[model samples]
Target: MPTLLKKGLALMLCWFVSSDLYALVILQYHHIDTETPFSTSTSPDRFTEHLALIEASGARVVRLEDAITRVAKLETENEIGPGPDAPAGNEAFQVAITFDDAFISIFRTVFPLLKARGWPFTIFVAPDLVETSAQYLTWDHLREMQRAGATIANHSLGHEHLLRLKGRQTDDDWMKRVSDNTREAERQLTMQLGGNRPLLYALPYGEYQPLIIERLHEMGYTIFGQQSGATSRSYETPKVHPRFPMGGPYSALESFRTKLSSRPLPIPHRLLDPLLGHAETRPSLSLHLPQSLTRTHRINCFGPSGALTIEPVGEGQYLIQTPAMLPTGRSRYNCTLKASDGRYYWYSQMWMRKLANNTWWEEP
Candidate 1:
């Protein structure tokens, strides 16, 4: 009896430890106008309803910068200070509200509501668009929002997709197109706001290639992308932080709740691995599967020269042994899998670097 009791206590302790790594929801908004074809533009009344739902959820609303700062500090020091106005030890349930593009409506509509509630938010602006057109926020409006505690960030100069540049362009041309634009935008934002340059960047259209991500990192940006899902310990990357797009005509409170209650979409291993550039050096690869797969599944990793196969060792886990002759360097690899239910999944990521040891270690 005592042995059984001890085993039950150990299982409870394990559950407690696992539950401590709660997920963070970063909600993204763009435009907040009534006319955009995009389903994400939330009307003012609907946005307020969304806010009311968030409040009812008992989640603390934080700015994207604040959320990033909290995550970084937690990673570095293993602690997050008490959130402003948050209860002690309740930081895990925090949410970050972010707006992309300097829409005039955001300043005229959203900012007032946020300010009234004393809520924090992050706004990404394309410096070139500010104050130029009726659709975009003017510099005065942006400054007013900044004064009201909304953190402004750079969203590039022209909102161009950095990854779609012509392949024939010279390295200098590419750098000017990407780096120079960001630099100038930074300069303008600092000059207008009279504060330090914004460090956060939202990828245009939620699109980013690996090279663009590297360039943004070089330009001192620590966060990017528009992929939507709750962030947990396993999904850590500046290029693809999960953020649910909110505040559109279709962004009713019911829809928002449904999205929040849903589990993350299952990203295929084939689609995920190549983005990391791991195919060349470690010819073999493994994927962490969702918990519901009770039976083992086969994962196939294919390279230019040959193919390798992996099998699930346990639920949502697979192992692959690679060829010793696999050359080292950054190479894109593709993965495909067939589950027992006959559904096929595909994904890829970049493979870079070869480790001296093959032993598995826990990822931080």
Candidate 2:
């Protein structure tokens, strides 16, 4: 009724609405066992703590598909706040849990916990390994999980580094092989899981080049990468939708909370394409940050070694040169900045280096 009281209420509502506009994070997991190589595994106790923390945080845990659809719609329609179909109290921070590789631990461990909470998740499976690998989930196991509110999506046929071309494999041959591999996986999944699943793709080993992404785009599939950043409406296409990996050291509660609150750093669309380091194995990256992120002084970039060299290229743009040619493995360059709200804005790009004529790669 009073003018001053009405103005105060309006300001609070505006703050709430704006904050909810960018409230989304996608977390990727691999294994949840203490015995299965700690690099990709998180101890069961830690995993339990993770779920408990999410439950107590007052944040909604949504299905991966729901989060993706909402973000795509938000970017296209430019609508903010809860939509007409949105449920009550959904206009807050949200998270989507996704597991890759379809490890046995998923069905044995992670699936049960998620099921108990009545939460939804997505699992990316390499169809070729379903029955071949003893450690992987079998078709029956996956089918049961799917029946229990899980989304089964394609990771690839064999989960090979999709960007690496075999010896004497020409560009055309590589393209055909990749296309066939992807198509075969889709066929296999369709035969088993029915035709109602979403065409979501998770890159194997978190590696990809611009051309590979372009080819995937042409094939009509939604893509997700293992880069360490928060996904948002700005990343409307699957090509650049970054999902933070949550395993091993990253599964700790403190780090998990920080990552859960992370925001997507402003990266221009043209400059956001996947950059691959071919012969050099280590490539420099240039970024043109959005003007809204004026805290340039707080921006920091780091690689596998440590802090990287960040040199100003021009107004609101910087060049990050890697310190060394990355070893023959998966490495990433991560950038984070201090947001006005005290949470960090994050962005990451992954690199997969291959040895030249190296026997290690030729082994069966």
Candidate 3:
């Protein structure tokens, strides 16, 4: 082989050797406007910069379906499958873009820019909100976007917190309601969009419990939540797959860069529970990592308050406890282990508080 061809082959061999370690980072966005009511809105200008930075970073932007399928396949197979947008020969770090709630701003601002980039994305919409809320995207808008290469999935009927039940609502009734709401959303999306509804489910408010997850699993839905973590082969969940939420303060390009460059830490399933209960804030999160990770001392876990307390339990097992009671709403414990090469291995667990102890879940 010529000198240049020989160099190319050597690089390819290196990629092949390390392909199993590659993970997918999924970035979640909610709105693309400056004045949206929710704190989860990314300004249009910042949204534009996000796309530019993602493109400049040389990360392969993939559809959400492709990411899920690729990660699921990677769990069983050692090789990464060449999905819709992935190149067959290279082991590139993949990033997928997703927007929840189907904001009109997404259609007005985000769609044009992403369409120009020739990129594919997924949008989860609550049909009830779309029907009644003027701020949300209408069925026609979603249909147009879908025709233009966006995949529309189910968020829920009214974006209610699916895990919580009313004060008097029995557990069986709550489960029945949740099931009906999801089926209704899927049915409406299929009716309006003229295709089979995608199995993708973005949990409303990024909150889920074991009961909720079990219900969703029975319905054959692939769940994605707003937790921060990279999805890798070792990341297996028939319940909830995590996507890093990027909105409001998180939309800054620097934070985006750090999140985009992070890798998934192979955490055993024992520590994967959501750990939610009434008035319970500080839950214990224990992780047992493989021995191959030699930087256990350098691993740091952080909550909304700051650095958490990490205690060594045994060989390759550590106990991480939240330093304070997590206030109401959704908060996460984010841990990162810095590698020698400067990349960080990431893991996160989400904690949710019921809206009120007396009545229906409180809205904070």
CA deviation > 4 Å runs, candidate 1? 1-20, 78-89, 170-176, 232-238, 247-250, 258-286, 290-314, 318-364
- True lDDT of residue 288, candidate 2: 71
Model 2 lDDT on a 0 to 1 scale: 0.75
Question: Over 4 Å off in model 3, which ranges?
Answer: 1-20, 78-92, 166-170, 234-237, 270-275, 295-297, 354-361
lDDT of 2 at 178: 76
The most accurate candidate by TM-score is 3
TM of each candidate vs. truth? 0.66, 0.85, 0.86
The 0-to-1 C-alpha lDDT of every candidate, in the order given, reads 0.61, 0.75, 0.76
Each model's backbone clash number: 24, 0, 2
- Note the residue pairs that clash in candidate 3: 355-362, 356-362
Worst 10 residues of 1 by lDDT: 80-89
Q: Give the TM-score of candidate 1.
A: 0.66
213: Cα error in model 3, Å? 1.1
Model 1 clash count equals 24
On a 0 to 1 TM-score scale, where does candidate 2 land against the true structure? 0.85
- Write model 1 residue lDDT over 1-364, tens digit each, in one string: 6999998875544443233234356778887767864565777667788888888877788777666666655544433332111232345566778888888788778888888889998888988888887888888888888887888998888787564453469866776678887888788899888765458888776655556666777666865556545543322343555566674443767657744432222333122422222234555556765443323545566654567556667666766545544544334345555534332333344444433453222221
